[model samples]
Target: MRAEDEPDLVRVSLAADAVFAGAGVELPPDDPRTLLAHADRVLVATASDGRPCGLAATVAIDGHPHLEQIAVDPAHGRRGVGSALLAAVRAEAAARGHGRITLTTFRDLPWNGPWYTARGFAPLPRPEWGPELVRLWEAEAGIRVRPRIVMAGRPG
Candidate 1:
């Protein structure tokens, strides 16, 4: 993602959060600026007009890329934007010499856990979580009421 895309990160994230509302899941508002700034690598998917429609943000965790956020504007849904962003994250992780990518997500949300599962990620049991991942999961649990799972997938 380019520096110019930073301004659109918040917009894309909020638009993507609409999915959670539609699914009857209440989530705290998302502000992606901080994460965007700190991400190990960020990938953006653009609309035909050259505006950003999706983003995948990752941070280093236990020496591997951990997906911090993946958001696609609802207006651009079903266009493979999210998938493309994720694939890019995986490829980038591989290029960085990481064998796998990790993440935390709602266990049953169609667009959350299931989406990752369909793309090759599998649930990573608590015992397998690294110190940083365990801390991240615990922190997330304090703020989120939904059941969440940690997952990892090869950087294919």
Candidate 2:
């Protein structure tokens, strides 16, 4: 993602959040600027107009690339933009010599857990979690009421 893509990417993410709101999920407000600025790697999918329609952000966890967030504008949903962004992130992780890509998501959300499962991600048993993943799960517990799970997918 380029510096110029920041604003539109932020808007796309916020627009995607409307889905959660409609589902009666009260997600904590996230600052896209902060997310972009701090992400270890970011891949964006853009509309023909050159505005971002989706994005995947990654961070490092125990030497592997962890998908920190992924969002697609509701208008662009079901068009494979999210999948493309995720694929790009996974490719990046593999290129960086990471064997797996990890993420945390709401366990029951159709677009969260099932989507990943269909893409080859599997629930990583809590007992198998690394220190950083455990810390991340604990941190999320304080902010989200919905059940969440950690998932891992081979990037190879």
Candidate 3:
């Protein structure tokens, strides 16, 4: 994603979250900039009209990579945008020599935990998560607002 894509990306992300999560969880204005600055890579999926349809951000920690955020526009659901973004992030993680990729999702939501599970991620015991990720979960409004399942996938 380019520097100019941050606004649209953030917009799509916030919109998707609001639709799926029923709460307006917008990133801080500078959050996208910070994510792009620190992430191992950021990937976005756009529609034919060039509007961002989905996005994913990955960052490395403790020699493993974690998918920090992934969002797909409700209008574009089941059209493969989320899957493609995930594939790209997984490939990027493998290329970076990361052993595994981890993510957290709403346990009760079909589009959240079930989707990840369908894509090969398996539920991870909370005790297995690192302190950094645990702290992030504590800080995340959505995760704190609802019960979530943490999952991980090892690169094959």
Candidate 4:
């Protein structure tokens, strides 16, 4: 993604979040910028005209890839943008010698947990969490009220 794409990706992130609001999951309104701010690796999906319409941002956690956010504008949802970004994220993580990708998401949301489950992730036992991951889990708990869960899968 180019520096020029930042604004559009931010827009995509915000617009993609409508799904959560519709689901009655009231995420912090200030979250997208904060999450995107810390992302070290970001994959962007573009429209035919080349504007960014989706994004996948990842950061290292416990010395492995951790997906921070994967957001696709509703206008582009259900068209494989998110899936492509996930595939690219996995490929990049594997190329970097990472063993697996980890993430936190709402456990029951179809687009959150179930979506990833269909792709390859499984619940990561809490006992397996590293110190940093435990802190992240706790931080998430401090910020939201939802059935959040941690998951992992090989970055193949």
The candidate that wins on TM-score is: 4
Score residue 150 of candidate 2 by CA lDDT. 92
Which residue runs does candidate 4 get wrong by more than 4 Å? none
lDDT of candidate 2 at residue 137, scale 0 to 100: 84
* Model 4 TM-score relative to the real fold: 0.95
Error of 2 at 83 (Å): 0.8
Candidate 3 lDDT over 54-121, as tens digits, reads 88988765467889788787888778888888898888877878788988777767777888888899
- TM-score per model over all chains: 0.94, 0.95, 0.82, 0.95
List ranges where model 3 is wrong by over 4 Å: 21-38
For model 2, the run of ten residues with the poorest summed lDDT: 137-146
Whose lDDT is greatest here?
4
Off by over 4 Å in 2: none
Local distance difference test scores for all models: 0.87, 0.88, 0.77, 0.89
Between prediction 3 and prediction 4, the one with superior lDDT is 4
Judged by lDDT against the true structure, how good is candidate 4? Answer: 0.89
Superposition TM-score, candidate 1 onto the true structure: 0.94
Candidate 2 residue-wise lDDT, 44-151, digit = tens: 898888788999999998888899889999988999998898888877777878889899998889999999999999999988788998898887875466888899
Give, for candidate 4, the lowest lDDT window spanning 10 residues: 28-37
Collision pairs in model 4: none
**Candidate 1 overall lDDT versus native:** 0.87
Local accuracy of candidate 4 as per-residue lDDT tens digits, 59-102 = 98999899988999999889999999999999998899998899
